[model samples]
Target: MDQIDLDLLATLEADARLSFAELAERHGLSKTPVWKRVKAMEEAGAIRGYAAQLDAAALGFGIEAFVQVTLQSDAAERFEAVVMAHPAVRRCHATTGAGDYLLHVLCRDIAMMDRLLRREIARMPGVVRTETIVSTRTVKDRHSLASAAKALGKG
Candidate 1:
């Protein structure tokens, strides 16, 4: 992709709600070109589908926690299946560290978090142990895609 394509991605990342005409106006291009660029990016898998960013607190998920899981055996696939099936598990990553997998979980309250740990995670087939750290605050939750694009000289 060229500089114009990078600029288009950066603009869309800032606000996906911009119309083709608005994007054209901002980028000094015609609507057709703007639309074509966005479409091409989508087809090439560079531009993913968009969605609204929601507040977990407003949605009754007041507790956010990270869990470090150690497995009893090399049953990562089995454990991964269980983690993926649970809605409360927002993110999970396989890592090369003190733990086998790292999980980000959301819950309504402390009681809900406790239940999730005891009834679900602890009893999972391959789970040997888990350490959970509750998040007291979120400092930086936004993406740095624009800066990354700029660093690549695409902006």
Candidate 2:
């Protein structure tokens, strides 16, 4: 995408709830073009559906932990099955570093986290070891496309 498209995406990423007119005004464009560009971006899969970022603590999930999991086996099918079954795993990534998978989990409390680890996650086939680190503080947490773009040297 060109600079204008990138700029438009940046503004929208910051606040997807903004009106079309507002976006157009921010980008110094007419409403029609802004609407068309946004539509095109959406169709292209660059602009995914917007979502509200809620606080886990306020939602009854008082504990946040990053669990590093090591698997005895590296079979993709088995790993996919285990990861897909657990809804508490907010995000899971197959890594290239020391651990095979890193899972971001949200739980109601320490007890809940321990329960999930011992029962669900630890019991999964091929799991060799698990390391859990509870989040004491979140310095930065925002799912914005503009931040990604800037990181990639597009902004």
Candidate 3:
């Protein structure tokens, strides 16, 4: 992607609701080219689907925790499948560290989190152990695609 593409992405990252005309105006281009660029980016998988960012607390899910999971080497796929099927698991990453997987989970309260840990995660197949860190507050949670582009020298 070129600098114009990066700028378009950055503009969209700031406000995905902007109209094609507005985007074109911001980039000093016409509507058709801007629309085509966005379409091409979408087709290329560079531009993912847009959605509103919701507050977990407002949605009645106030508790958040990072769960570090260690699984048996042989049961990785099985454990991952279980994790993927659970709605509470917002994000899961396989890592090269003390833990095999890192899970970002959300729940109604501490009690709910406890039940999830005891009833689901702890009892999952191949789960050797787990460590959970509850989040007291979220200081920053920006999805910085623009920053990423700048870091990669694309912006």
What candidate 3 gets wrong by more than 4 Å, as runs, is none
- TM-score, candidate number 2: 0.90
lDDT of all the models against the reference?
0.90, 0.86, 0.93
Tell me each candidate's TM-score. Answer: 0.92, 0.90, 0.95
Better of 1 and 2 by TM-score: 1
For candidate 1, lDDT tens digit of each residue in 51-97?
A: 88889999999999999999977788889988889999999999888
Ranking by TM-score: 3, 1, 2
RMSD from true fold, candidate 2: 1.8
The candidate scoring highest on TM-score is 3
Model 3 pairs in collision: none
Residue by residue across 1-155, what tens digits does model 2's lDDT show?
Answer: 66777888888778889999999998889999999988998999988888887888889998899999988865556976878888899999988888899999999988998899999898887888899999998998866666667678874
Residue 143 lDDT, candidate 3, scale 0-100: 69
What are the runs in model 2 whose C-alpha is more than 4 Å off?
Answer: 147-152
Q: Candidate 2 overall Cα lDDT vs. reference?
A: 0.86
Query: lDDT winner among the candidates?
Result: 3
**C-alpha RMSD values across all candidates:** 1.5, 1.8, 1.2
Candidate 3 per-residue lDDT, tens place, 11-120, comes to 99899999999999999999999999999999999998998888899999999999999999899999988998999999999998999999999999989999999999
